[model samples]
Target: MNAIIHILQTQSNGILEALGQHISISLISLFIAAIIAIPLAIILMTHKRIAEIILQITSILQTIPSLALLGILIPFVGIGTIPSIIALVVYAVMPIFQNTYSGLTTIDPNLEEAAEAFGLSRTKKLIKFQLPLAMPMIISGIRIAMVMIIGTATLAALIGAGGLGTYILLGIETNNNALLLIGAILSAILTLIFSALINGISKLSLKKIGILFSVVVVLFGGFAGYRSFVKPTVNVTIAGKMGSEPQILINMYKELIEQDHPNMKVSLKPNFGGTSFLYKALESGSVDIYPEFTGTVLESLVKTNKNVSHNPEKTYQVAKDLLKKQANMEYLKPMQYQNGYDLAVKRSFAKKYNLKTISDLVRVEHRLHAGFDPDFYQQSDGYPGIKKAYGLDLASVKTMEPSIRYKAIANGKVNIVDGYTTDPEIQEYDLVALKDDKNHFPPYQGAPLMTEKFAMKHPEIKTTLNKLSGKITTADMQKMNYLVTVKHEKASKVAHDYLVSKKLLK
Candidate 1:
């Protein structure tokens, strides 16, 4: 049930957009393979030994893991959709190439002998008779290649190619079954439709329908390739707590300035990573824009901010001042979203203990088993700080990844879990995000920071992003977050829903 809802949500936010990315990789890769392989296969059939060696070599490329192969290609091809498509195409080669080779070579040698006996030229024999007869097998190979490419294309999602695999991976990271289901179902549906199309074409006379199918594949594939890899100037990467925020603002920018206003390309590159790493990526210029928190950037990155717990607007002002002088960045308008850190226990346990705030935990702190993410366990902003601020000393502290700790709490393995106040699971499982009465955690309001140059060039982007500011309350952002990170719902879908619910997307 959750899975179905999740799929519907992702589909809403350009699930077709992701489908476009994945299919583009598959179709283009397969098309290029077809062009290269078909001619080579024809030549190989004529000259036996070289083709055997080449086919064997191509088979080895198929065995490389798609992720590893793509990683190796990234340095040379750079990022975005190109390296991904190239890798998928390389993966798609063997079956199609071999099939082409097999289709041409396996023909009853007598047909060629007869053509030779009739004094037909070699080119005429291939063009008139051989190519037509090889259609069924060649098409069969393409069909297999297409199916293989679809599955391999999932790997491209890891490299930011953006596809159904994005949902699949997010599901895995967060243990969201709905996301896994959405990924599986979408991929299955696409493959089924494509298979039917290929089978339908094969049923048509070899003289014409095959040409039509091939042409469509080539045209769509080529266009997709040009769009994904060739275009996309001015990249902006955002991740961690602010992972989905850019999707909203980016689409808005795409619609308004890039579409409504023009001649400026804005690529909102989303990178999912820990806070520290995301900061590093931003500093190095790997990301042009990121949705970040006001207090976190101040406290964690620039310690001169006096650890002052200020309001959202004040924090943004502080961030703007600090970022300009230090990081040369600008914090745009902030959404009414705050992702403050919080602690949680199972709902039943909380209810039984009447635990409402951090102070309440002091009485039972020693009795509870606390699990915190590794980074949070010892960091000043993590478990250590929470314990220091609340004065609640626990009996046992287990340091694990955030996802693992959440799972532990969910399964009753731990009585306490480190949590984000805005995490979607807090609402989903009804786990209470404790009131930070003592003010232990810093504020992390959802906000975007962009390069000064990009900002000056496109004022409309800031305007588009500013629309989302204050549009989502902390609780509302929590629900959207759950719909994605926990529920395995698509980010685009979650964003679209929030937009529609608010009538932002009429």
Candidate 2:
């Protein structure tokens, strides 16, 4: 119950922000669709054959997938919210166009006769009688389009367009169930509220259904208006590791600023890269701040994860020294979580060949199937080196996304799978992970890296992020990740709830 309250308090602002973006995309597209559709409908009324052909063309456009549409548009239009608006507008055209035409055509024959008998001009009859009568139907069509777009616009986050979908996508990727559940709950609520608002508008304007819609356009003219024109405003970018865990952490940082450090301007960019790539971005200053595993930095960055001196303190020290000297980066405090690499297998397979470590696979590796993400399969620290170090020769290896590979293993398509130690599915799927007794891989401990420039601008950014370092135990992270990816929650809620539950923030 404490966890639930913490989530609502922390993520409510982000949910509102996402709602704003979702509504902006939906309303703008709907408005544009009405402009295009209404005219087309009027022309179709005048020229029936041409309208049929135009409607058929729009029908075909509606069949394409939203993701696919975004993909096609990305190469030409590039990224951000603009491309999202265009795709949604295209999607909206068919419904709005059809409804407008139907409403106009279905007007009472007697009304037309009355207009004609009154000796009104064609334009006058159309505007005074036909248009007013069609208002309710037109509004209904727009309402349907609005609802459809609200749901579909959730897809906008895929191409870096900010919306509630950002949380949803990342939650699924990392297997964080809390993140998934909270995201769903918030998105559902927003849709229902927006639907109610629009319906209220229809009732009030159309004047028959006894519904009243009072729309208040709280226009935040721009970012300048949202922000105070005071001195000492700080700009900070906090990037998370790709998927839900990172997204959640970033959102937590944002909430912290809003709650305690309103003078600071916090901008979050989640899913920067895998643990290793984020290190590169940090070193190069392309990214200002990012979350990472401590063991990962110790091994991949400092090259210090070894069979000897594998303790956490020594690992953190070695990594800290390396970052200070070579990368011009600083670590504030470690996070509560320690996400690490894990290896999984079916319960039957682990028992069958006595597979307990990297070395054990050598005995029956010939008959086993191996699976990992395609990128993980080819990395220098991946299977190639594992083969050389442990002599675990497998019969075959397959590559797939981290999401799909677990299913592959569960279905018996593969006997062995690479997994994140913090992933919840490792527990839910009841898979067994072997210990790397030989210490074949390096450690991956998480820390936030901030550029020297960013540190000067926003000191609070480092403090807020670093507060979470070393906070999440392996099991805790695994559970959070499971809720995100497997259960379909939201990342912002996951991070916020986790922090609040742990008393890191109010």
Candidate 3:
């Protein structure tokens, strides 16, 4: 309880910002769904054959996984609030459509006959009688959609559309319980508030619905207008992976860029999936920049795996050349840290086995089980490559989520796990990262990746961002990660303090 209160107090501004985003997107999505579903429902009621087909289509859409829907939309619409809104609207259509059709068709046959006998026009009857009678059912559909959207909108954070989900995603990535709880509770509270409002309005007369809806439109329109008029002159968007290090780097870049150029508005896009989403977004012009590792660029993105060395400078050079030649993206200078994946074990396990390096583990390979993330397990440099390279294999292995890999090893669920050298858990759990004596992994030096077109348009951005190069050392990154992952500190605050200490920002 104290932790929750402290989070609310210290993160009041962020909570409010996320709150506004959450409400705005939810309302907009509900409004859009109503427009699409209500009219389609009315039109389809007359065409029974067509209605069945359309309803089936909408039902199928509702069944599609939310994350999968977002991924499908990202390449077409790119990231941010637009794609998020589109996905939410798709998910929200069914309830509204079904209820609207039910409400209109469920009217008594005698009422239609009486209206025709009284010579009332079709449009007039629909407006003066049918619609008013059906209003309750229509409102109920909207209520259902509003509630669902409130929850679904939380996933928007995965694609960089800010909401309370931002805290939740970041919380899970950094392992911060307080941040996770805050996001979850606030989202529930927002849903309840909107549900109550809809219920109250549903009980009122049709005239009251119109009046309340108009008020909502006016308020939202005014806020939109205010934002448009005050938009910044130069807009720079920075995207990154879901982990703590990427968050730190992107936040650091945002702070530096905004501090150096007050006229520019810098946005941080968080990608919860992986680097592929961001890479495509950058190429497709959805995002302008992101922090990438040299080895990942060369090996994973560039597919230049053979004979890669442990030298950071060589890795950076190779990655820069390949990226520039193939994708027209520029690679900035590398940071003073190597975050390559290494096999790690609890210090006690290493001591008991007398293991100090990758080669040393071969002796105990048959007796030990290993845990690794599925991504690492499947990658070329992962377990498969490791087994072939060293001619050794573990007795058993399990693929698990990256977030739990460290905990799994620490708790004796596995004897070894794949981990980044800079992971804070290494220090927290008193784990020893075995030496890579044969240079099996490429040098994973941190660097900034930006599209050449964006760089040329805003040449100053590259210069400003490159200021981060050679600044964040191994210890610096580990400590910053520890603050967020262990101490529950916000990434922006951690980045800001690091910049102040480096004399890079005021």
Each candidate structure's TM-score, on Cα atoms with residue i matched to residue i, is 0.59, 0.57, 0.88
lDDT of candidate 3 over 82-110, digit per residue (tens)? 99999999989999998998899989999
Query: How far does residue 172 in candidate 3 sit from its true spot (Å)?
Result: 1.4
Quick one: best lDDT, which candidate?
Answer: 3
TM-score computed on alpha carbons, candidate 2: 0.57
User: Model 2 — which ten-residue stretch has the worst lDDT?
Assistant: 209-218
Ranking by TM-score: 3, 1, 2
Candidate 1 TM-score, true structure as reference: 0.59
User: At residue 96, what lDDT does model 1 achieve?
Assistant: 75
Q: lDDT for every model? A: 0.71, 0.69, 0.86
Better of 1 and 3 by TM-score: 3
In terms of TM-score, the best-performing candidate is 3
Q: Count of backbone clashes for each model?
A: 3, 45, 0
Writing each residue's lDDT as its tens digit, candidate 2 over 37-74 gives: 98788768767788788889888998998866776665
lDDT value, candidate 1, whole model: 0.71
